[model samples]
Target: MSKQYRILGVIISLAIGLAILPIKLTSEDLHSGNLFLAARTIRYTFTAGILAFLLHLYLNRTIFAARWIMVEYILRIIVIALIICLTSIVVDAIFNKFVKESSFTIAKEDLNWYLVILRCLLVSTVQFFVVFYLQLVEESQRRRLEIEKLNRSQLEANLSNLKEQMNPHFLFNTLNTLSAITNDVKVKDYVSEIANVYRYMLIHNKLNLVLLESELSFINSYLYIIKTRFGNSLNINIRIDESILPTKIPPLSLQLLLENAIKHNVASLDSPLAIDVYNDSENIIVSNSLLPKKTNYHSTGVGLNNLLNRYQLLFKQDIIIEQNTAVFSVKLPIIKS
Candidate 1:
């Protein structure tokens, strides 16, 4: 959420208050010295502005939590605004009907619900657009700055990468040689899958997005390596729509989820771990039954956090997480084709 949005709410309300002040004044009213009318006009205008601004801030904070879907966000804003407007009118009507008017809540006859709601809606809608534009600009600038920082970091690491990087060509050649010379067919297949996993990482590490099919293919190879290590103790089921094959996602994103499940859970021949990857209407879901290992496991949460940050920065979407004693699930939004 933007701190500027919160701070600007009061400032904008004050501005609106002042803007509506001139409309409140008339030559005859000023000449006649209608102090009560003057005070009521100013009070009502400022109160409405302040109320709307506060509501804007609260709703903006609540709804726009790392998930910046434009359509949904705008719809929510409009819906909440209408609700607040209607609620205000009903409350005012109730107060007028039941409560005695003294110093405050005076000039009930002068209050026009239609005009007041219209004015509030107009001012609030304009202010919302202004703040939303500012937020978008701030986010764009922040993203650019981050990208520049990452570029600088990559440059600094270039020398280290050169020194530490194993030549992929040589590694592939060696793996192919081992696979060719292996006496056992299973060992040959295992060697080939290991090569595939490494090759996918080397090829797609720098890419921002890859087709789901490509990522899933890489995952299959990666899973082969894992299954070889865990044997029948681990089972992975992936059922994705073929139509979604063209959809894009951050490369290696699913690997992080799969890795987390394998790392944290108890997977043995008995009570084998089951990890399921499937897709619904708009999202891909990864789910597993809850099975915590007895051994103390320290979690830094880097993998999932890294995945989350990438999605927010790249897609402006938040991954939905749901967990219980029985199952843990994450719904990852799929990028449109």
Candidate 2:
């Protein structure tokens, strides 16, 4: 048995033993009889207490089916009753042999041993049910917690897979943009910048979170490629607090938001699409003026969905999205270290 159970057994036994003392001392037989008979009564009460504790400990370790519960309890009651009766008889025999002048007896006429046996059975039955009920409740709670943990683990795995899929799509789009550049010199420089962007993606994609500063540096490399392609048509502004540099965010989160703005909106010499990145007390805000393309561009919104799922897994905070006829905005929470 565990140490905790051992300690509990000792405590319960002592409590019952002490509670019987005053009643035994006030009995006419015990008060009038010599000190020897009084001592024996106390010993018997303590022995019954110990026996009740043992029965409780034994029943806790044994398992019974629902159909067999009553049968098992009846069996326990019979066994404890027999043990208490045998103990009383043995102690009486020993006392009688030592003190022949005043022979102590637990005989039916003298001491009513049946009542003592009945009390032992009752206490044992009550203690067994109390412990059984507590164990049932504890096991049920343990199972519930395990199920919740399993569900959370499965969700995290799905979000990680979604984030990893973005890498290939991003590489494909960057390569497609590079293919259209006509200037050989400009193409060579853009190729170097694209290489740096890919290197960052490969190194950090496996991680759940990255420092905001590191992600911003990667965004700068990505913006270089975008600025080369769109020229004066795209205008991106950034205003972030240096104190929040140590904060963490999912990798490529900002890049995905900026890409979404450029994908759906019109950005040309006549109508420049301006995107702004800034931070508030709790979140990093990405906003842009809405000027949707005249021609329909098939869009799936996979990137934004992937970001939302990733944030849900990493933190409890929600990613806020707001839109109107004139502008669109998304707020990403900054995870503190």
TM-score of each: 0.58, 0.50
The digit string of per-residue lDDT tens for model 2 on 222-295 reads 99999998999999999999999999998778988998999999999898999999999999999998998888
Give lDDT tens digits, candidate 1, residues 213-324.
9999999999998999999999789999998899999877898799889889999999999999999989999999889888867998766766776777677889998999
- The clash numbers for all candidates, in the given order, read 0, 0
Runs in model 2 with CA error above 4 Å? 1-188
